[model samples]
Target chain A: MTNDNNDLATLALRDVAELVEEKLIKLLPKAVDLEQQVIDAMEYALLAGGKRVRPFLVMESSRICGVGESSALRVAAAVECAHTYSLIHDDLPCMDDDDMRRGQPSVHKKFDEATAVLAGDALLTLAFEILADEQTHANPRVRCELITALAKALGANGMVGGQMFDLLAENQDLDKIRITRLQRMKTGALIVFSGESGAILGMAEERRCQALRGYAHDVGLAFQIVDDLLDEEGDSDDLGKTAGKDSKAGKATFVSLAGVDAARTKAFMLTDQAIQHLDIFGDNAENLRNLAKFIINRAN
Target chain B: MTNDNNDLATLALRDVAELVEEKLIKLLPKAVDLEQQVIDAMEYALLAGGKRVRPFLVMESSRICGVGESSALRVAAAVECAHTYSLIHDDLPCMDDDDMRRGQPSVHKKFDEATAVLAGDALLTLAFEILADEQTHANPRVRCELITALAKALGANGMVGGQMFDLLAENQDLDKIRITRLQRMKTGALIVFSGESGAILGMAEERRCQALRGYAHDVGLAFQIVDDLLDEEGDSDDLGKTAGKDSKAGKATFVSLAGVDAARTKAFMLTDQAIQHLDIFGDNAENLRNLAKFIINRAN
Candidate 1:
């Protein structure tokens, strides 16, 4: 058996993922006769292999903030759908030009570019559709807030905005502040959204919600820094596609600004800062604290 | 001055459009300078000049339903934003491939394709964001319902789905039934959403909402049919773009399916049906009724 210490966190994460996954499968409407093709594409993208890190954050924050599992599951699925849409668009030829994802051909590579685009667009719209279902319609005010938060996280000021900045930053020697801001918007915003959404939906105290946002912001930056580090040192086989591709693509990353060692140190500092934000919750935030450590030290 | 009969409808529409335009122009937060860029693209598409028909429908419907003009303006802007996003995306290189819009270069033709795509995506997200602003936070349930309605109108089951069908039907013979379904989803959904959303937001009677939906549906189909006839007969200079491009692209169209005379007749019939739906509301729906008549006889 695995060591109980790490296993406990792993077990909790797995349980959350399993529960969210089951809820999603149940919530998704199966195609009856003619719309099977569209349904199939949706299922393929959604069910494809990936660690359920975002959903875990959603559920963990909700639980810690005293929200029930059912309500949090809707928020979890909504974020996952948004993330999946980003992945679909990012893999397009005009975008990242990626042909592989998660050890399989990307959506466009497996199907076609048009289909992939539509699938991504459909998933993005469906996220809000699912959240507005009759089951969650009871909390109408909170539901609208969640929709607004998710849209802001996904829109120009959030992920798409960050992407535009990243695109403009290509091949340029960028400063540390600009690079951090870019990553914070592109990668960190959604992560913050994932955790903060849970807090908002759970009706957590305003101060606690603010604390969660702070925690997520620091963790997200540190997480991306670690990802940059891994891309420098990890093997393509382990990464499922590439390593050092960022540098080759003239992309700006933390390692490009500072040496690998310095980037690593900065990453650790961010992680420590992230953990410090959890001090208010004390031992109740053990999973979040441990998750940050795991993210920083992740191998594959 | 314009004829008194025409003056009231024209002046009221112009008043509503100007009000919504001013509000939207001021809504983007100045804290993020990048937001200005987003607001610029959105305004470029929205304010460029197209009659502001969709916004007029929203505002007029809201007034008929006893909804306040302030709340109506927000939904009007939201509907226009959604419509503008569709136009931007439809003009992209991978989609309709048009080069001109409202007598100017298309969003993609003017800006880069990637920028246009992001702009369209941003505008779509902004619609929800604007609705959820603290200003309108008073009616969260109404906001949530409108957001869900707009999402559905734009998703695969609606405009995007209809576009997919059109793309696949190119150079292929599609039956009149299939063509009707395509136009209904692609064009009808949003118009229906525009008319129905006002009533939904105003808490109008369910029967009145249904009547508005029915009226909007017929009018939407009539608008498409009229557009088809114009494409076949309109001058490029007068229409602000090259006419007959639909036939050049070998795309399926109502004129191609039923011929020009039949198409015109059908448009008139649809308009009549739409006006009939408004009879239940009588003079209160005069603006909507006049709007339907105007749609069938539009010059561009």
Candidate 2:
């Protein structure tokens, strides 16, 4: 892995994560009764933690667009909820069949499969609920845009469709273009949404939003390639997940189809393209440029 | 079952169902690729069709409030999407473990569990997406309100929590009050939302909204009690579902706690209370009044 002197901290990611962490707990409903079981499962899956990439992207991107920390934090938390819900459902026995997520026992393993399913459902519902609130944004139009955007990113035609393609891809060999399209729908959609959210909240000009979206798109694909490489090359302990499952499942991923050397080169090249998209922001986009570099270089 | 000469036709339910049916198919994205399996599962689950009670409630309530038929139709379709999503998840092997719904094999039975899960998830996402659309309501505020209402009715503190309570209730003997609370959370919350949605779309006065809410509450409870009665007494063929599963599972229900006679009487009393809440609207509420009566008396 290529280590960089500059990391996400320079971008206020720590502050964003801390604020999002605090708000996530407050955002969760109290387990006052019998239903606490599912709530417990939800908190376990949500708070067990990931690197908080989506939240960081939402907050930092929103910050660059001059959106308030408070509003960005709310949107960030909602993004995490949406991300966590996807992880929970994806790790189900019928899906990825993973037993660990973010280094913790998967929701179905920690709780029951039924609890896991309901917890994911509740989390997904909560994400929309949070975005629909006044605290997320003062303008109803802005809130509606956020809601629709989030829905589009994760709906049947987006992430869900991508997952379906992935399941099918395991049986049939897929070419690079098909795999790229699958990865875009599967993971890139949400990443694009994460990057675009701040602009939507800040009501940034169309061109700026498009610029951020382009940057996000390039980095998002690069990020997935790195993930594919890690799945093939990294250990589970470092990845904090069951690594190499892609190869073991006969899955058609970039790393599986393209040689590791070519895959790594593609990731780096894509990261460069991503950084180029942020050139319009000049010095102000320094953090985003470095963030792209960091994505391709991260070990876990 | 209590037979009534007047049925849902008096409320224009058939027209609402027809329009909502068309809109539902339109609202669902076309499956153009490998992901068609999940989309097919979604369509099967959604279009297999329940009685379309939620859509009817939304359309009729909106009609009484002078909201346009087109706007009501969109909201109605959204409500049905949410309803169908819940039903899909509820019938999963991990949850109710039912095999039949709307006289068709459950999603999990028809397709694979993964497809069923994704289909349910996509339907839930589609519901929020539909509600967030400008076509659903011209005002962004109204759209936001609808989104929040649907989320509140379905999230961890709402229907999800209620389902958790229900799963726990099966292990221990519960009283009628507890059963009522569980039912309120599980099914009643969505039903209440169906009734209140028209007013939310109309931006009706607080008192009028409260009236619809109250009417919805009573009718929702009455509707559940009748469901319990049907679970116990109705044939599986008539119900178009696997009846006696609740009793088979030894799940404590309103009918289990209170004798059939008491449960039946309570349903009628609640129906009367539901009808009384419509007094303010007088002639305008006749359809709602008949709707409430029809809810308690429906054989299915």
Candidate 3:
């Protein structure tokens, strides 16, 4: 039964990933006469292989909320574009300065630093354009809600703010609460937005939205904890990134503050809690439930 | 009579600027505990004084098209935020590397480079949020139109692409056509959006929109040409920025490609052409006509 569930989750994730990728490919602007390089850079950064977890969250949440596939896919693509833009900027020389992303050269490394910056800016702009387009949803109110949620999540008080904290927190002693806050802002906010987007799209009741929010909160933390755990133990090749970066930088992570065993136990507990929040959706949220487990248990 | 027109233009510009500034102050996110610095950097960059020409264009265009002041002011603030974000990013070390803007240290210089990047990101994100808000317009379609216009203006094919071209065109032999195209993308796109936004808000006829487009097109180029002229001849103190950097970098500008006298002549011609497009609106477009002349004649 457990094996069957794992297979089902993997298949579902793969299916959504393919659909989202197709939509993203169609949505990205084609290379024009003089602006080819920037477009190429954008495509390169976005097309680099990842698990597409954020888009999956958007699609699965939308499906459970009874939104149409076209609207869901557009939002999913926008979420992915925003996520890719963040990664591109985060890898810049003044930021993390990582040369590799998803086992390939980072956008800044592949193109020039200036190109990387412009490409990132373009991608960020494109995300809002996608959300604002009429095809995203029949209801303009729904579109506006998606835009507001995304802006709030990605703004200074959320993802960018979290990044600022991460930069300052380097070499500083931080407790679990501070770390959690940092992670929540840096990684969890977008996840919450992705999940909540479905509720907005389907015009779900407030209780339904709150339950998804709760689920997103726990799942996002668990995902971050697992990231920390993987950084501590996973090989660079398997991770497709420079592993152990946190320990090398002396950054305070969950695994660094708590022992590996404690951190793993905590992630498992959070996964369980995240699943509990889906009780309101019952059988309709099976994929989400499996996703919570998959997030903590993934090898990379 | 000319002096009287100038005075009226100056007073009108000031009024719009003040309105936009007040709205911007209220619209920017308040500093939270840890993310206070990023918010500070965003405020610092945005509040740095300029002539506020883009917002003025938004306001004046909206007024001419019969849009309400409140909705127009919100969009005006949004335009300023987006423009400010571009300026902040343009000043980064990997980009233009300017240390000063509006007679003060640039955002990256005042803060750190990472903060500058994140603050710029936040501000850009905030621009969309403001446009997406219900306060921007009663009609969701209008809000979406504003967002789409801003996004396209600031996207890869627009401002970012123009910047990319500018970076690549440095020290390269380029003709007036290429230079104009680059300038249109770099600077003219946003100006066009600012003007066109009013028509979108008012739901004006296509012919009215086209008139604003023509005005924006000519005004935008004239604005860039005058910018080049100032960079060539104006004092750094008066300009509130380092002047002559384009010539110093061996950049091909209208002043460089065409001599100063010819470039000045072209600016005058463009301003006249821009005014000619406004004839359709008659007395309602008087402010816009004056604004066109001001674009060419401003000392700073």
What are the Cα lDDT values of the candidates?
0.78, 0.87, 0.90
> Sorted on DockQ, highest at the top, how do the candidates line up?
2, 3, 1
The 10-residue segment with the lowest total lDDT in model 2 chain B: B1-10
Q: What TM-score results for chain B when candidate 3 is compared with the true chain B?
A: 0.97
Per-residue error for B176 in candidate 2, Å, reads: 2.7
Q: Provide all candidates' interface root-mean-square deviations.
A: 3.0, 0.9, 1.1
Residue-by-residue lDDT tens digits, candidate 1, B162-212: 766666667988778888888987789999998897788779888999999
In terms of DockQ, the best-performing candidate is 2
lDDT tens digits, residues A1-300, model 2? 234434554345566667888999999987667898988898898789667878988977887899998899899999999888999999999899999988889999999889999999999999999999999999999999999999999997889988988888885878898898889889999999999999999999998899889999998999999988888989999789988889898988888888888898888888888888787777888767767767776734
Residue range B37-87, candidate 3, lDDT tens digits:
899898888888898889888888899999999989999999999999999
- State the lDDT of candidate 1 residue by residue for A1-300, as single tens digits: 124545666777788778877776775544422234444566677877677788888888887888777788888987788888888877777777788888888888887776677677777887887776546537787887787778878887788888777766789878888888778778888899888977888778888898889989988888898888888888777777667888788987889889898999998888889889888888889888887777776633
TM-score of each: 0.93, 0.97, 0.96
- Deviation from native of the Cα of residue A222 in model 2, angstroms: 0.7
lDDT of 3 by residue, A171-206 (tens): 998998899889989999999998888899999999
